[model samples]
Target: MKSPKQQSGDAAERRAETLLTGRGLTTVDRNYRCKGGEIDLIMRDGDSLVFVEVRLRRHKDFGGSLSSIDQRKQRRLIIAAQHYLQRQRWQGPCRFDVVGFDGSHEANWIKDAFSA
Candidate 1:
């Protein structure tokens, strides 16, 4: 059985996919993983390659969902993205995006959330 966290992640990915698609982004990959780390979603937004991190939180007691993706997480994502590109031999324009979700309060799409 999948852990609760895993299940939550899956749901978040699904929501993120729908949201991105609604905004005209085409999903290329979901849960792209490597030795470095994992990328929640990889998509194409117009001519740019988009690497998205999907975050979900039940409430904003400590901090909002987006705030959870801090510097350390960003570094890991960057490393993972590099690994993905190296393996795919991808040489194109890319940007990192964060899709933050907290129940029923509009999902926030933070584009170029971090640098590679």
Candidate 2:
């Protein structure tokens, strides 16, 4: 059985996926993992490949959901994205995006959140 936290995270990722798809992005992959890192979602926006990170924070005590993606996390995402690109032989344009849910509010989608 999945833990409550894992279930909640899954729900968050699903919500993010739905929102992205509604906005015209097609899902390429989800929860893609490599040796040292994982990507929450891989999507295609027009001719560009998009790597997405989904974050959910029920409480806003310390920081917002988007703020949780710190430097270390960014590094991991970048490394994982690089691995994915090499494996898929993707030489086209790619970008990083972030989908964050803070509390019970609407989703926040930030395009080109960072670079690889």
Candidate 3:
């Protein structure tokens, strides 16, 4: 059985996928885990690969959820992304995206949130 946090994270990733699809992005892989970290969603926007990080916060009392992805988190995601590309032999353009879900059932998608 998954813990509550795990379930919530899954739900959030699903929501992010739906949101991205609505915006013309197609999902390729999801919940990609590695030694460095996990990428919530890996999608394709046209010919470009997109690595999405889904952030959900019940409230904004302690900064926004997207703000929680600090430098260390970014580095971990980068490492995981590089590992994924190397394993898949992917040589296409890629970008990082952040989908921040505020409690009100809306997620703000930040494209090109970071670069390698």
Each candidate: what lDDT?
0.91, 0.94, 0.92
As for lDDT, the candidate ahead, 2 or 3, is 2
Residue 47 lDDT in model 1? 81
True-vs-predicted CA distance for residue 60, candidate 2, Å: 1.5
The residue-by-residue lDDT of candidate 3 on 14-105, one tens digit each, is 88898899989999999899999889899999999999999988888788888988999999999999999999999989999999987876
Tens digits of per-residue lDDT for model 1, 1-116: 99998898798889989999999999999899887789999999988889999999988867889999988899889998998888888888999999998866778999998887
- Model 3 / residue 81 / CA error / Å: 0.2
How well does candidate 1 match the true structure in TM-score terms? 0.94
Estimated TM-score for each candidate: 0.94, 0.97, 0.95
For model 3, state the Cα shift of residue 18 in Å: 0.5
Per-residue accuracy of model 2 over 10-100 as CA lDDT, tens digit each: 9999999999999999999999999869999999999999999999999876888998999999999989998999899998999999999
Point to the candidate with the largest TM-score: 2
For model 1, the stretches where C-alpha displacement exceeds 4 angstroms are: none
Sorted by TM-score (best first), the order is: 2, 3, 1
Q: Please say which candidate is ahead in TM-score: 1 or 2.
A: 2
